[model samples]
Target: MLDFFSSNPIIALAVILAVGLAIGQIRFLGISLGAAAVLFVALGLATANPAIQIPPFVYQLGLAMFVYVIGLSAGPVFFKEFASRGWKLTLFIIALLISLVALAWVIIKALGLDSMIGAGMFAGSLSSTPGMAAIVQIVNGQDPSMVGEPVIGYSLAYPGAVLGTILVAAIGAQILKVDHLKDASEEGLITAPLVWKGVQLSPEITGKVGDLPRLSGQSIIATRIVDDPHSHRLADPQLPITPGMQLLINGTEEAVDKAIAALGEERETKIEDTELIYTRLTVSNPEVAGRTVGDLKTVEHGFMIARIRQGDTEVVPDRNTVINLSDRIRVVVAPGRVAEVRKFLGDSEKSLADVNLLPFAIGLSLGLLLGAIPIPLPGGTTMSLGFGGGPIVVGLILGALKRTGPITWQLPFHANRTISTLGLALFLAGVGTSAGAGFRGALTDPSSLIYMGTGFGITLISALVCAVFCMAVLKLKWDESMGVAAGVTTNPAIISYLNGQTGTDLPNRGYATVYPTAMVGKIIAAQLLFLLL
Candidate 1:
């Protein structure tokens, strides 16, 4: 068995991934490693046969692919946040990370541990795969033998980091008697409920659809209008409105109520008929992607898009609503025009699932090139972004841009997620196999336990700092602070647990708010920790 695995790396990898993922799926006290389990599985497999090795390119490609996708997903929100409250949050995270590094330094000194191992422990305890990659690159720049040394420390500390943060959040919340859900409900911070409503136009009202009164700073889209009792049409700005007509709108319930009060009497109206109908379409066509709803030429196509659902958030779309790949848009079209609209939007599920290789390849190539470029440093020494940093940096920029001329740098949401998972899994498995021999040796060392304990301490400290700073200083809610800690740790398991406890996406909001910055920050911190050691 060992010899077979040693000979064929592909078969070995498949076995490791399959087994690891299965192991991860087993819930232990309501927690699972999810994709991170692949690492341990690969490590165990490799220990049985030290010759079982995957090529360097596989891991390198995996690292680049993983971080690049993360960058793309984070770019839009990261920039938007920076423009608002990101500065304070960014500073807080940086300080917290630096403090953790200092703490790790102290522990490393006390234990008399190797600097390389200490660096790996720091990365592992913080749950940063990118950090581990960065450390390996700089440390093993000349010597490949040292590559496995750090991974041993990473392995010891990885579990501690994951479990420690979760424990702290749960225990800390209970100790404080903080009712996260109740607090949110009381604060009116809960997400608004969406609804479709109708308003019967007052006899005194008469104007174009855009002239309708609406809630200030709230979403209220005029989707359809009933002019004659027998016929209904899309609510276009050019479409004239007369007395005794019903305007059908979709938006948050509160926003709709206010608009209905302003427009006329609230009424229930059936808008769909033979002449006009609406259908939901997945935006999979490259030609239409990155274009706004108005650019679709709805009038020319005898259609009007009223709503769009992107991931978990849904919005009443406008002319300038830039359509992204995999967005589900509600389009009201002429009865006979559904086929044409479907073709134009590329509504096929197959198209939505399959990635456009042209743009993906080009974007990845650009990221690789960026990573290779030498970055100048002080004292004539130069640095590079390497595999971990380069692709992510490029991804962030392209993600924010969304499109350039004709090329959509961003992939569909599903495609991005799929590629990200594949990349991360491959990288973890490869790293595990590469470092397996050293890890096996380290298992018997007394200091391995010390590293594990130290990692747990670091995670608890970091989690505490994040929670305290977010709640006490930033004045955020308990759930949000815990969510922020989860993001800082860069572990999805922690956030998933929080969601289960809270039964709301409020925690997810906090997680996403800082995830991008925290991810990039932790990567830099890991490298800095290595250099400092």
Candidate 2:
């Protein structure tokens, strides 16, 4: 059995992972899979096996999808949040990162480990794959097996780190006893209802209050009183009644009793025909490109184009306003005519089909090409153009800057979600496969175990410090503070878990805001530790 297991190591590892996942021990799967992959590679290297290779293209594709989705999720608000509330979180995270680098340097010096080993250790401590890649790039001519070890270490550490962070966040929220209802109300998630059972006239209604007897004691205001009620109502009727009234109606049980007891006369007002005629629809067809808003009128659909939103800008569209893919259009049509308009626009199932695959391909190619370029670092050292910071940063910047290729590139949200989920799952699977093999090695080395322990310790301490700073000094909400903490720690899972606990989606936004900064910090720390040590 032992001989068979040793002979078919990868398969054995896969079987273990499958069992673990089936049993709902997802973390176990991660650890097992990662260990298996690393062991496979290590054993292959030991035996001089040429077949053991991580396909660079497959890895790149997974990484690109991961980064692009992350960037998209972060969106424009990430920068805004950073500019606003990111300072304290950044400061604490940076401080911790610097401390980790210093600690790695000291440990490396004391242990007299190989330079490559120390670099790998530093990268592992920070869990920064890009940093590992960078270090490997700088240490040219190093054994490929040795160069790969740091990435393996990072992969091994990630699931544990994520799980640990999520646990901590859950504990913190429990300790804080964050109330979901109160938080939601504070965040304006609870909106006032549009209509109430009764209508009330305020004391401020001085200028000959219209038909007071008709609306004197009813819950609903007559729709016919105003030709356009939407334009006139300053506030929704469901709100609490204000003072000063020509006619007032009550809604609360006690208030209704008092009104009835007072023998207030009841009058019903006639309903009006003032329903909204326009509804908005996003442009989904690739063939519709270069067509104007006026061209839309040529279709059999009886609708008038009202407005268009192109990216962040909203325009009062005219005939010459070209209809581009992903442009959200507001069209006014007769009541119950939405189906006709949709029919004319073609199948609703075809929206994502319009995404110009060319631009995405171009962007990806540019990322790969630029990522592959070996640019010299600060110390006359060159790094490879790979899945590291240089390529992703350059790709994102260039992609954002390019304007002429496609007027509108709509990210198919559903497709993007599907791709993101798949990429993440595969990436996680790879990490797990690699970690399972290295788990034994990592545990066996006292010094390496110390580094891992210290790394986890630093992450927890950093998160707590950031949380404290955000809450006490910055006066951020507890959820937001926790979110900032998670972000600084570079674990979105924490934010997601905390959000789940709070029963709100706002924590996800907070996670997104902090993730990019955390990524940058981790990479910087890893590299600095390697270079300085």
On lDDT, the leading prediction is 1
Identify the runs in model 1 with alpha carbons over 4 angstroms from their true place: 183-193, 201-208, 211-217, 238-245, 272-274, 376-382
By TM-score, the best candidate is: 1
Model 1 C-alpha lDDT per residue in residues 1-533, reported as the tens digit of each score: 98999999999989988998898888888888888999999999888788888877888899899989888888887777777777778788888888887888888888888888889999999898888887888767858888877788889899998889888878987898978778777755566767887788777777677566432335677777776645777778667777687877877788888878777788877764546787899888888888887677776776777778988777777677788899998887877889998888888789877677787777788888987787775556555677888788888888888889988887898888889988998999988998888888888887788889988889988888888889888888888888888889878778878888777766776787788777777777887777777
lDDT, model 1: 0.81
Cα TM-score of candidate 1: 0.93
For model 1, name the residue pairs that clash. Answer: none
Q: How much is the lDDT of residue 229 in candidate 1?
A: 48
- C-alpha lDDT score of every prediction, in listed order: 0.81, 0.50
**Overall local distance difference test of candidate 2:** 0.50
Q: Which runs in model 2 stand beyond 4 Å of their true positions?
A: 1-53, 86-96, 107-141, 189-332, 336-340, 343-347, 353-355, 369-376, 382-407, 425-440, 443-448
